[model samples]
Target: MTTNGECRTNGTRRPKPLLSRSCSENYEINDVDVPGTPKTPRTSTTPGHEKCTFHHDLELDHNPPTREAMLPEMSRSYRLLLESLGENPDRPGLLKTPERAAKAMLFFTKGYDQSLEEVLNDAIFDEDHDEMVVVKDIEMFSMCEHHLVPFYGKVSIGYLPCGKILGLSKLARIVEIYSRRLQVQERLTKQIAVAVTKAVQPAGVAVVVEGVHMCMVMRGVQKINSKTVTSTMLGVFRDDPKTREEFLNLVHSK
Candidate 1:
C-alpha cells in the first residue's frame, strides 16, 4: 500500500494529509505558499463613512433607532395587546399582524429615540441679517399624550435674528422632531419656539399652532370640524405688541 510522502507507479505522488485530490499530486504543498488569484481591495474604514453592502445607514445610524432591532420586542408586546383586546393573535388573518403593528407603532413614536442635538447639528448658521424670519404653514402630526390619539395641523414661526439663524428646512425638521412625540398642542407650540430660541438665541421667537385633535373628532366631544389654536411668544415678540400683532396677522392671512 502507498504511504505518506510515497510515489506511485503512475508517477503521481500520494495526496497530502490536508489537500484534496483536486490538488496537483506531483507538486509539493506548502502551507505558507498559497497560490491563487490576488485578493480584492478592502473597503476604506473611515469612521461614519464605511461602505455598507446592504441597508445603507439602516443599522449604523442610531440617531432615531433602527426598526429591525425593535421589531422583536415590539411584536411581542403587540401580541399581548391583542390578548388584552380579546382578539385571537394566532388566527390566520392575525398571525403577522403583530409585526406590522409593531413596525407602525415604532415609526409613529420614533421621536422618543431622537435628540435636539442630533437634529440641530450643523443646521444652525451665524448671520448678520436681523429681520423677522417667518416660516408659515409648517405641517405637523403628533400623538396626544392624554388620549394617545393623533393631533395634526400646521405651525407658523417667526423670529427676529440677533446674530444667528436656522436653516429653513431645519425649522421644519424641528417641528417634526417634537411633533412626532406624545404631546399636547399647547406644549408642542411652546417647545418649538423654545427650541428655536435655544438654538439661535434670536432676539425674539414666536410660534403658533392650529391643530385638529383626533380625541376631539373620534371620541369625547366628537367635534369633527373643531380646531385648536395655541401660541408661544418670547423676547421682543412678547414684549412688543406691534411685533406680536404683525406675526399674528401674517399667520392668519391667506
Candidate 2:
C-alpha cells in the first residue's frame, strides 16, 4: 500500500517541465484600470505554482486544446459582453457577431493552446559552430491582457548556440507561440527569450520587441504615436556588453 501522496500526484519530479504556471494570478498593471475595463482572470491548473525550467510566472501548457469544445461557452460570453456595451446582440446584423467574435478571440489567444515541445517538433540539431545566431524583424501580434486589445510589431531574437541550434523558422514560431496570447510587452519579450533558451539550451539569448498597442491608441490617453519597447537578455547577453551591443546593432540595421 502507498503511504505517501507524492508518488500519485507529484510523480518523479520531471526535468525541465514544459508545462508550468502559477497557482494564482496575482500580478497586475498598476494605475491602468479604466472606468469600465475589467482585468482578465487566469485559471490555475496546478494546486498553486511558476513551475518551469526558467520559472517564469506563465502558464505554458503542453497539451493541445479542444477549441471546438470551448466555442459555445465563449460565444455566450461575447454575447453578454456585447449586451454590456449597450448593444442588441439579437439584432439581425449582429445575430452572428458573438460567434464570430468568439472564434476570433480564440485565434488571437491561441498561445495557451500550444506547448514548446509541440512547436519545436524535434527541430534542434547538433552543431559544432559556437556562434551567435540572430533572426530579426519577425512579425508579431498579441492581445493585451489588461484590456483584451492587440499589440503588434516586430521581434528580434539572438542566441549564442551551445553545441546545438534550432531551425531558423522555429525562432519566429517561438514568437508566435507566446504572442498569440493575452500578454504585456515586457512579459512577452521575456517569454520569447526564455523559450529560445529552452529550445536549444543556448549559451545566451536576447529578445527585443517594439509594439504599438490598440489599448493605448483606441482608448485611455489615446496617443496615436506612442510605442513601447521591451527586451530580455540572458546568460552571455546579460554578462557581455560587447556581445549584446553586436546583437542590437545587427537587429537595428535595415
Candidate 3:
C-alpha cells in the first residue's frame, strides 16, 4: 500500500510486513546456517555431568575387580548349589568343597586351554627306521559329554611311520588331548588315531580305548564291572588285517 510504502526513503525499497498469526500456526522457514532442514532439540542429558542420567547409568567403573571380591561370590553360589542337592554345605567335611571342586574342575578340563601343536612341539624326529611304534596303556580320564561325569581308563596308540616318528610321550599327549575333553569313547579313540596320523604322516595309525562310562555304570544299568571298548584304524591299519592284528596283539600284551 502507498500509505506504508510511501513512508520509506525514496531510494530504498520498502521492507515487507510480517503477517499476524496465532501461536498454533506453524511457519515454514529455511535455516541457512543448518546444512539441511531444522531439527527438534534432543532431550538427552549431556555426558560427564553429575545430573546426566546417561553419564551416570551408562558409564562403567574404571576399577578392576579384585580376586577376593570374586571368590566369595563364586563360592557362595556353588555352596548354594550343593545345598540344593540335599548336601550340607557347612558340614565339616564339605566346608572347603566348593574351592576344591573348582580347582579340580579346572585341572580336569584344562585341555580346552591347551593346543595339540603346543603339546607335540618339536617332538617329531626324522627317523630312517620305519617300524610300528606302539605306546600302550596310557592312563586317560575324561568326562562323558552327556552326563558330565568322569569316565576313565586306558588308551593304546600304534602308528607305522613313513620317515617321521613322534616321541613316545607325544603319543600319550595325543591321548590326553581327546581324553581331557568331554567325549564319547568311540570319538576319542578316532580323534587320537587321526591326530597321530596327521602329525607324523604315518603309514598307518591305530587307537584303542577301553573305558567305563559313568553314565552307564553310575546311572543307567549300574553295571559296575562293565567296560566299553572302542577302536579306530587308519591307512594300512584299515587296509591290512595283519597290521591291525599285530597292533591288537601288542596292545593286549603287557
Per-residue CA lDDT of model 2 for 34-107, tens digit only, reads 11112342234443433322112234342323678778988999999999999999999899998999999989
How would you encode candidate 3's per-residue C-alpha lDDT over 1-254 as one tens digit per residue? Answer: 24442213334432211111111221211211111111432234324433432211111232223334445656777888899999998899999998877666656755554556777888989776556788898999999889889999999898876657889988888777667766778778766775775577666678889998888887989999999999877666766789899999999986
| Model 1, CA-based lDDT | 0.70
Instruction: Identify the superior model by lDDT, candidate 1 or candidate 2.
Output: 2
Q: Which stretches of model 2 miss by more than 4 angstroms?
A: 1-65
C-alpha local distance difference test of each model? 0.70, 0.72, 0.66
Q: List clashing residue pairs in candidate 2.
A: 22-49, 23-48, 23-49
Q: Which candidate, 1 or 3, has the higher TM-score?
A: 1
TM-score against native, each model: 0.72, 0.76, 0.69
> Top TM-score: which candidate number?
2
Query: Which 10-residue window in model 2 sums to the lowest lDDT?
Result: 14-23
Model 3 residue runs over 4 Å out of place are 1-77
Ranking by lDDT: 2, 1, 3
Clashes within 3 Å, all models in order: 0, 3, 0
Q: Of the candidates numbered 1 and 2, which has the greater TM-score value?
A: 2
